[model samples]
Target: MTPSAVDLSALGQRSSAIVDQAGNLARYGMDDVAGAGVRSGESVTLQAPRTVTFPDGGSITYGALDHLGRPTGVTVHITPDMIGAGTHANASILPPGWSGNGILHNEARSHLLGRQLGGSGDLTENLETLQQAPANSPVMSGFEGQIRRVVEGGQAVDYLPTSIYLGDELVPRGITLDAQGTGGFDWYVRC
Candidate 1:
């Protein structure tokens, strides 16, 4: 079942510091859980906001690692030039709890900012350990397709993808995506 607005509000508040501005934690809808199927997990966002600008002028802002050294998430500004046949060449620098043979073990060294969206596999803080099902799910791919379409059409998209963890769990329970494009499209998906 979907969580209530009040419940999400309370949950976000009680979790780590999510408010981008000071003294604004009570503004519910601004930071309300984005999707209908959002479950009971801590919501993460761009904690450190460190931007890595590509040669093509596209950029991705990576969040800081949590206390447990887990990635908080990423916000990416994607352009047509940023999308390509992405690489998986660097699997050596993945985070803790990643099985060496991730696909064989039904786990993934997943990217918070997906490689298809110009994210790097080399950054440990940009990676997370995830189950293979959700990592490759149709729902997840659909959201990614929307972002891709906007960028392919020569529009820029500001996309935020957050990894949601339950307590001290090394693997995330789910991911949350918030995307807005210059093409006048906005989407929020939970997968």
Candidate 2:
């Protein structure tokens, strides 16, 4: 059966459950930290919003911010369909102040799943912290409209034609295309 034939409602539900559980765990973990009092320069990882899977198998993972912290933005996982007839496999949009070597990817089902770096900061440091952050730490808050991106080293890739709801507005500042392709990107609330 084609991917479309598969009933994703159940999968979506399961995905939601997993996301919710992660968020709850992060909250609980944060509660412990809060009990002891949060420290400056101390970063906590919180559960992001649910991963919204598209009918075509592409998915977008939301990021979170604590009430007293800042988050860069959410991560976008694109599928082959989302990539369209693109020739290049290695592509990404890095955030501002990104000092990383390159984009990260994991191969699955003979396809390379690129992990777009979401949020802006020291790429090396942020990536390390993101990997090290507890699975139960809360995400930073108040980062709904401040996302940006810059293309890094790689062959020019086709932009994904899609629109997403970040809080209450379509992304890319009135455009519905995925402009975060193979480079540095950032996001913040627009006045």
Candidate 3:
């Protein structure tokens, strides 16, 4: 009953060639519950069991974009070895609804899984348009720092950062940060 790349397409917009290309890159998690049985606001875990590891050791999975080209959710396992060291140089890829002046004004091309956390800066599937206030504020940075600290200490953490879009809006209303570390760390940061 896990959600495939195509099954996830039904949740928002139709699948496109771009979505297919992104799906091919990351490993997707299957839905434990039937899609039809899912109710609004109910928690849905769309990943396979934790024992199912990625081939690259620390890999990320980006759900296909909705028909509107908005990001759905992004999942990644953060490990110390996978953290990137240099400054992030995002490739020339832009997320949906990107504007040089910002879609909502002051919107930033945010990374759901940051480059420091092993997310690809150039990957379109890993980017989203997030409000600059929260995206650059201490709240977001603090949460990411917590995850980085935990992982750097040699603990493995499973992180899922989801962009919460309201209705058909292209920009996310907020982002829900979920992380669980093997070192007895579990937290959710909604910003």
Candidate 4:
């Protein structure tokens, strides 16, 4: 399909899979993806996203989310023209299943991802708030960030379909300590 004639719905649905909160991305970590490897081992080096100005005098950006759905280190690439939500900008959400290293990011990409870090599960998603976009956008990703966006051009669209997952596994928070003091046991409680 021509870039101009791109079906916002088709594209949005094709690429939006933000649901499944407890997926692999949530389990090990998005950064652990081969391409988005951490700077070090198992240490999260998430990036704080900031909007960049498109050549057409507007702004555009993308980001990733931590297990808690918080924005991590990443940025979606913006085409010089159609990549911003400024006062005079036009935008649309690409469908789900359309992950290319070009202008969009997949769950594995270290650059940008769209997870709903904050929002009412039903509505009032935070990603939309950050972009100052319409709630009905096809690129908002629902809450899991399935694929949603709002355009200044005033075309009606629906957000990409979304499904969230929950990880029931929990890790015990603990600290091991050993003391060389006169305790009967060599590894007695230090605290």
Candidate 5:
């Protein structure tokens, strides 16, 4: 026979051991507690947003902010099924599946998930700060729109995709797709 009432205190104590964004209660395999399940030598999967062309002809795409708790490279998946088809049961728009690597070796940055350079600046404040700055300032000129504010290692790390690079090439800072294989992932370097 077992105790009629189970003790949940142990589980409660370990709650901080993992993060549950969607309230999915289950054990996830992740080595580092700080880094979700992502780290160097680890593979991560992220869900990317749809890519849309802006009025200025530049395209805007959003995706995986972080894996575990570190900056990561993002991957976009465009499969036939993922593509949008006019079907009631199917997704109205193509859903992008973004995979990411835990480690960020690229010097270039991806603004997909950037934390403000300041300790407490958020998107609104960062934008406001740029808005109040002189027109000649980089932030005033345009960095505001390209940068995203996110927290990493308890500090804000602004991610800028346009600045991402591989070696010396301006490539996606996160991941770049191989030219030979569309199915392959590429860092967001500006190559």
Candidate 6:
């Protein structure tokens, strides 16, 4: 099936808001996935499908919801026009402070360390504590590698989709375009 063009600008704007909230929660050792008002694990069939527009006249249409009936994910079909010049690859479209690396460290990893060390008094102390802390600490083990993969972005981690998946059925995420204009990267999401 032919993929449709999605406006990166519009998706960036909308996703930025969602990521901002998610990031804040992550920083505090929390996740919107289980917050009080969040929908936990509802069936995907109940949610309505919607079209997400981009600033450059691109758009994606899909329906997604988490367990709690809140929008959780989307599968966007990439088209030639969606990868136009000036479009960002993924979370890169978010503001500078929202880089995947930053979020991994400041939010996910740091929070884990804080719990392990009982809260260090300063950044230096925190680093020192982490340095002195056991390498096998449960919280610090797998996350660094996970963050590295996310920041690097390649075949294992791409923003564009070969297909679209949403809801409970595991639809493809992001956009997919013909091979001609899709030279460098596959796809990207805003942090």
Number of backbone collisions per candidate, in order?
A: 0, 41, 3, 37, 40, 26
Instruction: Flag regions of model 1 displaced more than 4 Å.
Output: 1-49, 55-57
Best by lDDT: 1
Q: How many backbone overlaps does candidate 4 show?
A: 37
lDDT of 4 by residue, 1-191 (tens): 11011122222212111212122112222222222211222322234434444464433333333344432222222222432232311123222222333233322211122333112122111122121122122222232121222222322222111112122111101111111112121111100
**lDDT, candidate 1, 1-191, per-residue tens:** 11111123323322222222121222234354433323445453324546678776788777877777787777777977678644553667767567678769776777777767777787777778776664544445556777887888878998777766666887766666767788776655555
Best by TM-score: 1
Candidate 3 worst ten-residue window by lDDT: 14-23
Mind giving the per-residue lDDT tens digits that candidate 3 earns over 107-166? 677776776776656655567876556453444555788789898887889777766665
Model 6 compared with the native: what TM-score? 0.23
Task: Superpose all Cα atoms of candidate 1 onto the true structure and report the RMSD in Å to 1 decimal.
Answer: 9.5
Residue 150 in model 6: shift from native, Å?
20
- Is 2 or 4 the stronger prediction by TM-score? 2
Score every model by TM-score: 0.70, 0.22, 0.66, 0.20, 0.21, 0.23
**Candidate 3 global Cα RMSD:** 11.4
- Name the TM-score of candidate 4: 0.20
Give candidates' CA RMSD values in order. Answer: 9.5, 17.3, 11.4, 20.8, 20.6, 17.2
Cα error, candidate 6, residue 175 (Å)? 14
lDDT, each prediction: 0.62, 0.25, 0.57, 0.23, 0.22, 0.26
